[model samples]
Target: MTAAAAMVRVEGLCKRFSVPRREAGLRAALRALVRREYRVVEAVRDLEFSLAPGERVGFLGPNGAGKTTTLKMLAGLIVPSAGRVEVAGFTPSDRRPEFLRRVSLVMGQKRQLSWDLPAIDNFEFNRVVYEIDPVHYKRRLEELTALLDVGEVMRRPVRQLSLGERMKCELVAALLHGPQVLFLDEPTIGLDVSMQLGIREFIRRYNAEHGATVILTSHYMEDVAALCPRILVIDGGRLRFDGSIEALRRQIRPLRRVSVRAAALPDDPTAMGRVVLREGGRLVLDVAPERVPEVVGALVALPEAQDLAVHDAPLEEVMRALFGREEAADLGGAIGHAR
Candidate 1:
């Protein structure tokens, strides 16, 4: 998309830091103070991408792959070493008040709510800082509290609230000003599965209601699969893949997974395809998409074959293969599709 059509734009973005280096010994450390040894580490390099307004895009990468650094740059938290970044029509490094009011960043490990004070107090403080009209502030606050179902815990001290509760409140505080852009970094880090699902649903609802553009980073594959239709895969400080989940599967894993449940086992199952798993009266097979119909036909011919299911490979496995953690041959043919 063109820069004017996008809510967030980045071009040839790069970030470098001069990290101090010293030997292991205390004597080496003392000598380094007089003449410090430094090495340049490129956190992000030649990064380029753009997000159309209201697009829920996933930012994915391994640890230290610069996902968080990219988010920080987009949020105007730090200046980039090179390239240009624009969010909401303003340069992020400038940290203009207009830009700040239009975007919000939430890091899972960070807390904006006061520990000793109730969450409500934090909300009020944010309201004053953002100079929200009292009438609109009250109306927005009510809508958020009800949507998050955190009205009961708003009066409780933030420290006393559970992790899930605190996270919900934190989102409320960040969103009090009705930001049109959201940068979320591991927003569901330690929550249980149910809590994660709840948070994901809330984000989907909020985005649909406000048409807010969202960029999210998470290690949890389920979060990405459930919320983001388009994903940006970055590794070694560069963009590796940008496409839909289906396209990723087609690129990395072209085989179709067929699962079957039967009353008895066939003497030779390899004739059909590779047997991935075999349990009591249950079997999983990996077969080429073109051969799926034939395999299913053969399996159905068996009197003992009671049920069968077909599906694509899992997202976690696709990501692992994308990062070169697993051999591409093991994932199957139809590789070389990624750009």
Candidate 2:
């Protein structure tokens, strides 16, 4: 796509931080009272990717893997030490008013709403901060509050709200201005399954309706798998893979999970595939992709077979396989077709 067609354009994006270097001792601390040592850590290395409007993309990585750093750079919260980042056709680090107005960020571990203030008050404050027209603001506030089921909840102080409720309010505040880009860092960090699903559906619906570009960083693989069709895996401050979840699954872990419950099973299940579980009336195998059909047929023929299934390996297994590889693993384009 042309430059004009892409809503988020990142090329050779990089960030580094000068961290204070210290040893764990009072002697070392006293020595550093006048002069302290520092070490430069490369938080984000050269990264290149782009997203079209209305696309929900995720940044997946382990702790301190630069996923959040990359998001911060794109959101203009931190300036990159090198490389370029353009969001909505404006340089993010420049922090221009127009660019700031076009983007909103919601962090799960951080609170944007005032703890002492009611969430509705926070939403009204955002309206003034974004300089949104009163008529449009009222309509959007109503729309978002109703959709998120927070009409009455928003009247309570933020500190009194549940984690999920506060997050819903955070989303409402970020979106009142109708930003073209949304940055979400762990939007469902500490919520029950039902609450997570509700927020996930809300985000998906909002993106669908508003045509906003969403870039997410989350430790919950299910959230990424559910909300994003495309993901960029970052490891060691570099891009390890960039593709759909299915493609990533096929790349790092191509094994198909074939399982069945039956009265009788093969004496040597290992002959068919790698055995995952072997219990009375049930057997699960991680079969090679090419052998899946044969394995399924054999499993179905088992005496009194039931609950037969053939499916790609779970996303967690795929990610574990990817990250378990040595740091010397090949670059983004080279890793492929591993079973």
Candidate 3:
């Protein structure tokens, strides 16, 4: 999409920080007391992308890959050292009142509600802070509470609510002003499977009803796989991949996965394809896309094979191969410490 048509635009984005350096000795520490040594770390490097209105995109990367830093920059929590970012036609770093009203940022680990007070109190507080019309706020709150199924918990103290309830309230508070853009960083973090699904559905419904552009970052692959059609992957503080999830699969991993349950094992499973796993009566194979039909046919013909299934490689495996786990591990340690 053209920049004008996009709700969010980032160009040549870069964020750098100068971190103090010190050795592991008392002498070095004493020397640093007088003068400190510093090194520049690039938290985000040359990021360029645009999100059209109502688009749901996943921002993915390993730990310390600049995912959170980029989200902070886009949400106006931090300024980029270099680059231009425009969200809903306003420069984020400017943090103008109008801009703030049009966008909301929700970090799962952060809480905006008062712990000692009821969640409804926090909701009312937000209405005043955002200057939301009382009538509009009431209608919006009712709608959000109903959709998130958090009405029963709204009157309870924030500290008394469970994590899932708290997260729902957090989302409700963030959306009270009716934002056109949302930055969600690990919104489902620390939630159970059912709770995660509830939040995911709420996000999907909110985006659909409001036509809000959403950018989500999560450690849960299921969240990304279910909600986002497009994905942007970053590594080592650089934009490594940006495209549809299907495109990412095709580019990084072209093989299809075939699983079969049988009463007896085939002495040489390699005849069908590369054996990925073998456990007693079950076998999993990685077969080329073109060879799937042939492999499935072969497996079905086997007297021992009872159930056979064909599928694509899991997103986790695809991502692991794409990022190279070893490289990500090394970068995580170095970049995490620097940041």
**Cα RMSD to native, each candidate?**
3.2, 2.1, 4.8
- Per-residue lDDT tens digits for candidate 3, residues 205-259, read 9999999999999999999999998888888788777777777787667888999
**Model 1: lDDT to the true structure:** 0.88
* RMSD after Cα superposition, model 2: 2.1
How much lDDT does each candidate structure score? 0.88, 0.90, 0.89
Return the number of clashes found in candidate 2: 0
Q: Which pairs of residues clash in candidate 3, taking residues 3 or more apart in a chain or in different chains?
A: none
lDDT of 1 at 167: 98
TM-score of candidate 3 to 2 decimals: 0.94
lDDT per residue as tens, model 2, 84-188: 999999999999999999999999999999999999998888989999999999999999998999999999999999999999999999999999999999999
Summed backbone clashes in each candidate are 0, 0, 0
- Best by the TM-score measure: 2
What is candidate 3's local distance difference test score? 0.89
Note the residue pairs that clash in candidate 2: none
Rank all candidate structures by their lDDT, best first, as comma-separated numbers.
Answer: 2, 3, 1
Give one digit per residue, the lDDT tens place, for model 1 in 79-130.
Answer: 9999999998999999999999999988899998999999999999999999
Span of ten consecutive residues with least summed lDDT in model 2: 330-339
